[model samples]
Target: MTEQLPLERLAYWLEKRPDAVWLTQPVNGRWHDFTWRQVDEQARRMASALQALGCQPGERVALLAKNCAEWFIADLAIMLAGLVSVPLYPLQSAESIAYVLRHSQCKAIFLGKLDQPEAFAAGIPPEVIRIALPYPTLAAQHDWASLLAAHAPLQVGHRQTPDELLSILYTSGTTGQPKGVMLSPRAFAFAASRSVVEMQISERDQYFSYLPLSHAAERFLVQMSSLYSAGRVAFVESLETFASDLKHVRPTVFFSVPRLWTRFQQGVLEQLPQARLQRLLRIPLLGRLVAKQVRKGLGLDRARILISGAAAIPRGLLDWYQGIGLTLCEGYGMTENFAYGTFNRPGQVCFGSVGRPMPENQVRIATSGEILFRSPCLMLGYYLEPEKTSQTLVDGWLHTGDKGEIDAAGYLRITGRVKDIFKTSKGKYVAPAPIEGEIAKNLWVEQVCLMGSNLDQPLALIELSPVAREQAPARVADDLEQTRQQLNAQLQPHERISHFVLVREAWTVDNGCMTPTMKIRRNVLEARFVDELAKLDAAQPLHWQ
Candidate 1:
């Protein structure tokens, strides 16, 4: 049977596995393990403390943290105490965090390590009590040790009902203000259960938790998946130590966003030139040896499954990994659907496809060419936005704003978002994602944004890799020109890139060019290039150099 309620699933392990290792955290180059029994007792104590504070059932309790063992513990504690978990993205702006807090009306919050504590510090009001995780901040009124000691263990006799609110997940807005999506206990239960059926996630699996759990993908697929499957989880200490963390844990299952996957590829290319690496991988018997060493070097040698999602991964990058024995199955879903829509399965992997619809989940192409899906994992609704919810959740079908198509093999290929389609002066709509994906495949290109928007034709705004930047400007320009020519040859006149403008600045979350999840803010990119795009020639520029 599929494990649904997190606390119930966790309790089973506590009773059955007792001494089994459940979670591991890295601290100061040392690893700490939490047994199933230990986690149960700690979470029960935390639940007792929350209840003792007079927190009522279904009250919103915010959790502000990065990926850690305590993050999951706190999540279970909140749920066991019959409260709703409101996840706060650690990298969000102070204004956005503040807005979510006030909007959710959370009476209490648990704080953890954050990159920008000061940015969101002022958002927490005086009345809202704060409990610190392992990493205490100035905003924390009470620490983890104090809370655990202050109260006895809670005896949560009953599991949450399916209809009860499990979490209030706020969108990582790429377009406008973030809105909260109320996910019911049923939604999570269905998603986890389906994950077990579709992906064959078992108790023996090991997971490396790196991405911020605030995102639905990580929340459902990694954190909750680990809970439901009784799998062991290892948390990354920091980006500087990610390499060592991966090696130390040597996870059997891994998931990454497109940007990070690309970064990994770039890292390898930096150590061994792409041309030489490609040549080495083609040396017959030596190729197998080379591939094995490369996979081991990247700490993915033991991985039974590797997933890529959130945004479109460059096909060439995915193919390269496949060539080296690591086949990345692209998964597709949004916050509205619990990231359980389509996932390319093991052994039956479809190249460049997000794979088939999950069991019990129905997927169809709407008349507008949008991907529509209805499943048990579909969200309850947008929190306090009934009209907006009615619009999106029409007739029990979630109208995904994503543009996708169903192939003959039943795999789904996502093209782009509905709002992302831009039209040029010629009145032809250009899907920037496919174009961006093509340019991003180049080893030298770090980031690429396709822009046109009322211009005569589209232009590719490219940021070269650090190694590419280290090369002489003439060489860099020559390489870019060659890349541009190659891309334009495959595109129609309207979709062709007019020029490649080298961006001197890096796009980051702090700079408002990237979301907390590392997804590019296209509006921000377009805003930065509006003036430059206007100055470009009408025809495709032959002189990129």
Candidate 2:
């Protein structure tokens, strides 16, 4: 058996299944496949190019690209050359990109397809070499093809230790400025091995890579796991074609965020009228047959495991998926720990909990209910932020900033962020995440943000589903009112949403209302909708005093 680390695993794949297809991409509407041998060769060439550019060991090389085969090639090259890889989300603004590049002191950057290169050009220093990816342009300052052609084949060695830094992932910075979470090679390997064990990922499994590689959860689970298990990974061409690409790949193992899963549910529910669906599901034999067909049509027929992480998944969505014979297991982790802190096993899964901690890690709920973790997978510390690092990691335990309770069965149910729990002026403490999760269960409501910081009562900002608007524009208001009434009946007077503002536009990363992981940025959302929320406060309620 091969050693359980990145470079060792890569060598194992190179020797064992050199001709096995490792990665596939759609370019100009055609599929391009790469074997393990081809991947290793390309990575070696890129490693040589990095060395030729005077990239010393431990230096950070940044890759700002959408999910592509070359992204993995570049990542492997960085590891092979004994350097650290820093992946950035392709959708991030030029300013955020510049901040990460400068903060990490990245020597070389691989810029992917961008809408505005001039914006990036203006922000980055002239000395920093910006290499455009496979599809080169005359406008690009440094051509990646020419650089690779001039470089010799890199010499591979076993110089990297488990403790050596492998990656520095920047958090989404929902609360404040993003911190660089430094993860070692061993940490990445441990997380990957544990995930494979828990989720039962194998070499025969196929994964559809769509999530942002910058995010640790996706990187460790999908990207690193590919290397460990020698699994094949397919990249979607664009966000617009994700559904089509998913059908094409028919991935055996998949992972997605909660928002996408909710959208999937909305899509299904929208196709059938609620009255018709309720009646149809009441039939025993026909309902089972219809559901089986629905699951197959949705390209989930082959999926053995579907994982959701990076945020809390609403229990309602979980049950809805379960009804359709799909198991959407939720996991929990952060950049500081390289993902896979806890995950629901294949057979032993729960609805709202993020399962138990992986075998390699130890987790404990603090006296105040904060989640604290200790593991070899834990990062060394934040890069260049010693003070913040000291505060976050004390006595070898990572203060996750999340409040949760561990059940008798060891499943971890995350309630809310410690800082996000707000107190109403009426002296009631409210955890908005659970409340928002409950409100989002309504199929018509796509996204909900609950806010009541020092206010008399809680209020919610809701984004309606596309189907809700197209099918019943006039009914949108009525449906929202009904939803509010239903939710209010379930909550105490202070915890109920006294009022809500209907936002037609979706909250997305581009709009700065959500993080890259699709978690709501409470500060930004509150600021943007302050006026609308204030207007709601002044309005009269139908039932409330």
Candidate 3:
């Protein structure tokens, strides 16, 4: 049963629990529920409409939307229509949107909630059919209501073979051009079902969907996992209502990135200062009560498992969550492997490690210190780029560009990216991630990027957290310098940071300094700060932009 494809699993749920509420969505502060039967009918209707639009079985269908109930329905409809899915990040630049639409040669697109629809609408080719979801969106030839009313529910849906193409998820474009990663039904089925078993997921679990569904991590973790486990999924209405919606859902299985987790922590500290909270937490009886109250307030009181991924989380942040009775299991994976690699199991978590490989996953270190993985869930190849595909997938092993070290206990610790490692003027190699992690332990810092390819010493570009921005400038600077000195004491002479350059603006997806997944774009930052870096003196400990 676990080996069945997601659509087959959806069918199983439709038969067993037709009336069960599988999706809950908040719109205009009102709750809208969709049962398994309704989900099936809607998906079928959309599938019929898509087929009616002259979409070939193997033709590409792009999904451009924020995380919503309709996003899931559209993706499933594409699968049911036998069309390959190509998801675009809703927050991506218009140029990126145009590039993906043109590169993938999508015949149609399903548009949903977007921040800048007008700015991006021109990216869609005129020939492509536009189907808009039930949201205030750009002008489209077909709308959700019209499509459902016009087409009957598809009686005979396309049954995907094990190795048939499922999706082409583009990379986050941290380095340069986002390569389209080709995935199949076999890849998702093996990874999601096995992950369900490993994580002990069940129908009773609840998932809060906020992350972009385009990313392989969120798609596999939230979307596919919910399909396999038959879990109820909920979507946030908007950023303004995120807090209220989160409280309303109270999801049992929550997956979040480091930046959001840090934001949550900062929100708590704003209401109740850390010093006061820490003092209360020291008391035996009062501590548990306070912790429980804090969890309840954060809407994580019902969470059975909390996962942190996408990037390395600061250890101090994890410890702070632990103090509040929330244990975050840090996992490691890549889009190429369907986000299945290593994950810290419940009750057996090792600090600073991503845990052991999955039961069926083969992991080894290359002589070049790169992490290599061969798993059933590995991607087929990159779309239309045979040379890049060959370079990535060699001899059945997925060459994960991450440098990692495995402990004697089998815990995998990601050291740095093989490409991200840089050399100083003296030709000494430096891995920035570990040093960035150390600098991130300070609550004042939000995002940090270390780059000094040809400089005498490496310097860090720091983005101050909201809390730090609100604090006294003198205090924040003094505290940051203290942290920098302590961090340098633990590092080798050449690896030590010469100066901490503070950026005035936050590195957001909109600003193009961060990816949609909240990872700092190193290349973008390096190029953006070339002029500033040249002016920085070695004697200066802190340079504010």
Backbone clash total, candidate 1: 0
Q: Distance (Å) between predicted and true CA of 24, model 2?
A: 1.2
Q: What does candidate 1 score on TM? A: 0.96
Best by lDDT: 3
Regions of model 3 farther than 4 Å from truth: none
Query: Which pairs of residues collide in model 1?
Result: none
Where does candidate 1 stray beyond 4 Å?
1-3, 537-545
lDDT of all predictions: 0.85, 0.82, 0.92
Query: What's the distance in Å from true for residue 73, model 3?
Result: 1.2
- What are the per-residue Cα lDDT tens digits for candidate 3 across 323-371? 9999999999999999999999879899899888986999999999999
For candidate 2, the per-residue lDDT at 488 reads 89
Better of 2 and 3 by lDDT: 3
Cα lDDT, model 2, residue 431? 92
- Score every model by TM-score: 0.96, 0.94, 0.99
lDDT tens readout by residue for model 2, 371-448: 999988888899999999999999999999999999999999998889999999899999988888887777777788
Candidate 3 residue pairs in clash (backbone atoms < 3 Å) = none
